[model samples]
Target: MIFMNMIFVDREKELQTLMQRLNSPTFELVIVYGRRRIGKTSLILRAISGRNDSVYYYATERNNLERFREVAQRKFPEVRYAREDWESLLHFLRDKVVIIDEFPYLIEEDKSILSTFQRIVDENRDSRTKLILLGSSISVMEDVLSYRSPLYGRRTASLKVGELKFRDLRHLGFSVEEAVKIYGFAGGVPMYLTRVTPPFLDWVNRELKRVDSFLRDEVDFLLRYEFREIGTYKEILRAISMGKNTLAEIRDYVKVGGEISSYIKKLERIELVTREVPVTESVRSKMGRYVIRDNFTNFWFRFVYPNLSLIEEGTYEITEGEYANYLGHVFERICREYVRDRYRVKKVGRQWWKDVEIDVMGLGNVKVAGECKWSEDVNPHSVLANLERKVERLGHTVDRYVVFARSFSTKEKMEKAELVDINDLNSWFMS
Candidate 1:
């Protein structure tokens, strides 16, 4: 295990939130959940570090009741006799902070534990026991917190740990250009980020040659963890990654017989896929497009999955002819996420009407619409003119126009929009 001191990076807000709850006068039932490798365990461990009155229990599948009883008894030998029931066990654990890690495993073994836990929390509501339920499986954790579950509203606090933002990525000693390229493949997941060193493509090339590499199997692991039908989910995500954005497009491509709405919802709940509607469109808009939200997964389907034969042969001769234009979309996504994180906008998403699509639109006190150009020498005037026409096409007044590009030819062309180079990205991600 990594030392607690070395575990956290740019997680001040999350740490503060957890600490505040830790110091609360009332009992806390905090639920911390997220996708795998997103650092949910690290956050919990770091939050409760150095607390003498804390017990961290990891739940596993092998005869969970016996394991739970043994672990609880070992942790509190004073109450070994009370292990027959949860209420008494919790009574003995009063005034202590308890962490149940990978909690879904226990639930799967015996689901009646939910109601038992519910009863324990209710009976000991006025006590000083602090309970934290931590899980990495997003779907199972969500179901545990759903309205139909016995512990629906029992949680005092819930936190969904997300990937690191652009600012947070800087802590890994990556430059602006390096960060963008790295994020396109490794994403903001800390585990993925740590595995990727500088010269990102070189590392990926090396990893791809190895049959046992985690990079090659991450997608499969993630899918198999949540869904029983891995082939269908893979087909759905593969289609989305290849630019089949709409439901009709994905369905036609995959040729799945049944309705895929539930599968899409499952993916959405886990943060792997997202359904995006125009910023101005209502939530029920039929013009929504499904997108593969994870950068690593997107990269896998676009490059790795299709060329598995080449990878297996260890040729390392994959062509870059088709890669340039792909990064443009990824760069646009990185820009949108950066703006949303730094500006704290009410809404940040793509805007479209008929055939016209604006790369990013941020709505707040001042409406901001942006056009991204992944080119060596961008024609600023033409880009701005096109963006202006799209803004007009939307028939909505935009107060600010921003353009992101690799480089610009002349300053005269940028009179209409603010030109942001790919290297100078810190200002865009700053508060």
Candidate 2:
């Protein structure tokens, strides 16, 4: 087991929001949620660190009213054990900040927990106590906050904690190119990145190629925990990671009979997959394609999962050979995400014109279009001309055309567009 030092990176904004809620004059019921290992518990603990009146309870599958009261009494010794309901518990301990972590586990054990919470929240409307409920399952969290739910419209604040940004990884002491490679493998999940040390490729090789590796079983565990149709989910993810992005294409590849929208939606809710259309297209566009949004998941399906037998035998020659092809897509995704984060564009996505496609395009105050090349050398003029033609073919005028490449040969400058090599990624982030 590789033990990583617990390091808290950037959550300044989230902390500020939570602090603001805690200091509010009225009662506040806040909902915080995200996928597993995205630092939800760490964020909450950090937010409530110095508070003396805070009570934190981690609900488990076996948790009941008695279990809750037992935990609460640990923090507040004056509480009586006779009260079994949440309402009585809250009334006894009113005006004290409380946090319930893994709240979905409690609901799974007792489905009527929401109704009980609804009553507590209603009675505590004028009280100054702040109640926070945190969960990892996105679908269950949404169901608890939905209009049909008893607790709907009762929360004073709701926050969906997302993955850390690429720019934030600069604190990890990696150069632009190295950070790109690490992000390609681990994305921004704190728990995933914790296991990664220096010498990125060596770490990658051991984690993915070795039998009995923790990461080898992570995806399977995550899917099986949240979904019932494990086989169908695996097939669907494999199809998308292998480049079958469209609904029709994925359905054909999986050969499942039922409607795939629900499965895909479930994946999306858990932050595993994303549905994207052209930047110019509307949200209702039928031209959307689904892609596995998690970098680790994408990399696993593409390289590790398919070659499990070979990996088990301690041979990774085929996987190592195909990894270069896999990095091409990673490079494109990094470039597009960088443009979106740095440029603050209205829209950033891939643009497809029939058979032609531009890898990254930004439409905003300054229209920008780009192509990513994970090659030894890139010809700036040829790449610029191709992008120009594609922009023209799409009947769109771009204010700036950028080329992202590993290295450049000409040592030349362009009058129409900009050439950005791997070294310039840091400069872009700073800008």
Candidate 3:
């Protein structure tokens, strides 16, 4: 139904690159991919917009060659294709720019599509034809670039479009708090953010938990298309979203424990979940935790998926009843992102040693330790004091202490630490 709001914020670098490719004298092979609803198609369309000379064809599951002919006819009605095969059709557009969205669909339908593209790209190395391919399936798109694939090492340029950050939501005209609270649920997915309306809680009730909601079916649509074992992946996502982060913890939470590592590896490959070690620790550290990096994905498993019955009966009255706890976790991510965004941090992530867990840590020229509180009326002094105690347990010297909260009990400044409230964050958002 094309429900995306289509505000088309950000993607300046990607847009610039795409525009630059159009001017290149040689043949251009561009690959753009990301998870669904991440604006890959939008970016391409914007690049090719207002240019009748270019052909933008969406390849479908069945009769993609026929569909290709139909779209090509719109652009070149007077020209006739010599043959019905993809090679003959694509060769017809040799001097033109052709973009095939959802190229993975064509790949699934015909396994020989890779060789077709490889032959075209090889036969047109010196030609000025620009071929841009895009896909929503991470694994399949990545495979096209793999050493084992026929089209490997052929792309002139590639871009993995990602989610927007909390700071990037300023165009919505919401207060900093409102944007951040919305980010806690919607994350940075533009599709979900566009559905957010006034009266935040009401938007949550209407847009999130409803049976017919696009978001309600989003995760399933994504997983079903990407993975073969959807049930196993969902259980793992639910386990991680519920705080079963450790391998052992996730293994215990999800009973079908054949090889949790392989499943987790697939999720990591897709960028749906991440395995994080303490900022100060090595990548191979045993204390690694698998965290869902996507806010909307986590929201689905944590709240929406588990409460389907309530949605089915249309009696889902409560919205964000337990959202505070979720935000408690989300606020940590916000502070960590802020530290990385605002400060020159060589390392930025959470740190934990046994029972002592620091919410945010940024190690650049100086080690900065931060405590994030999603509650009201925070005491910076006490938070810093407690944070100091926790930092001491790690046997390290922290050059500064920073506290981020919804609101502070006092504005009194300290020489060693800085207190940042929603207003402070809002200023950063604007900056």
Candidate 4:
């Protein structure tokens, strides 16, 4: 029930693309689906806002066919409920924008509804109207609208919206450090961001108390709503969250034997997790590791779920004390993310070497490594020496070796190696 001003950003291009598609003379059909709370509905609303054409947005519910008929009758009063054919539904509208949100619910209630929609779209293919379908259930969306289904090739365009990027966190008033922490914990979901408020500790406290908080129950809801194999999905997520990143480790932890292979395929299809192979010469090695695709989920699994007993026992104060001991390491990881994001914005991709990983590498085709020291005193000499060894390990000569420190690096250190101070860091991200 927590609400705030609907801050819309970062989807201007998507909206423009949809607008252009809708303006075409030929009848258009678009399918949009994504993880829940990723803002599919918001995107559609913003895209069509202030348009001259009539737009009807309907959300299907978990109900019987009679209930759907009643709801449809109420929404489209001009269309007679007695007429059950697809043509009647098509004839009811003219030159309008038709949006069906949660269309899968209707399809689930009555499988015939898919054919009905297909028939209607076929009859109206030459018309000026546009039909846009939205669904949050990834499985249903893929099965019904994907190329393998009957509705394959029927959609004019399909857009799969993903979570916001860490670089985009600044729009929400988060400093580089705060941005990384928030990104690692809450992630880039708009709904999650809405819950962030002043006195950051208070916001975190409130979220911990709420049973319906997205952090606590989103995984459960997603599994229940989207997949039939809830037990298997839960086991897989639990294994990943518990740091079983390797495929063999996951299979061993889940103890699914023969079912483990199939479960992994299913999880990948829904985009809940991904497998990461080392960026090395051995591209075909089966040495890949699994990672939860969403940052928030990863953090929740790592920190929150592990300490649920403490939270439920009202011993969070003691638990927070334990958390404080490791806060430095956590903050250091956040600092690395800040540097990595800056590198990406600067178009410097990742590079790795055996047993040595640079925080920021391949900066503008030059090998660079950095250490983020949030403390007031950053040992420039140690960091510089580390970078020197890393470069040696990488076996590359670099134009510059840079160290990014939140505080000031000594003048002598700057003279020795390229140094970016806190002010420079701020400007780099701000620009």
Off by over 4 Å in 1: 1-7, 84-88, 316-322, 337-345, 426-431
Task: Give each model's clash number.
Answer: 0, 0, 0, 0
Model 2 alpha-carbon drift over 4 Å, by segment: 1-10, 209-212, 317-321, 341-344
CA RMSD for every model? 2.6, 2.5, 1.9, 3.8
Best of the two (1, 2) by lDDT:
2
Provide TM-scores for the models. 0.91, 0.93, 0.96, 0.83
If the candidates were sorted by their lDDT against the true structure, best first, what order would they fall in? Answer: 3, 2, 1, 4
* Sequence-dependent TM-score of model 3: 0.96
Worst 10 residues of 1 by lDDT: 1-10
Best by lDDT: 3
| Candidate that beats the other on TM-score, 1 or 4, i.e. the better one | 1
Candidate models: Cα lDDT each: 0.81, 0.82, 0.85, 0.66
Candidate 4 runs further than 4 Å off: 1-7, 51-58, 64-76, 85-87, 211-214, 280-285, 317-354, 363-367, 370-376, 394-423
Model 2 — TM-score against the truth? 0.93
TM-score, cand. 1:
0.91
Assess the local accuracy of residue 96 in candidate 1 as a C-alpha lDDT between 0 and 100: 86
lDDT of 4 by residue, 72-134 (tens): 566567656456554565566656777778888878777787777777777888888788888
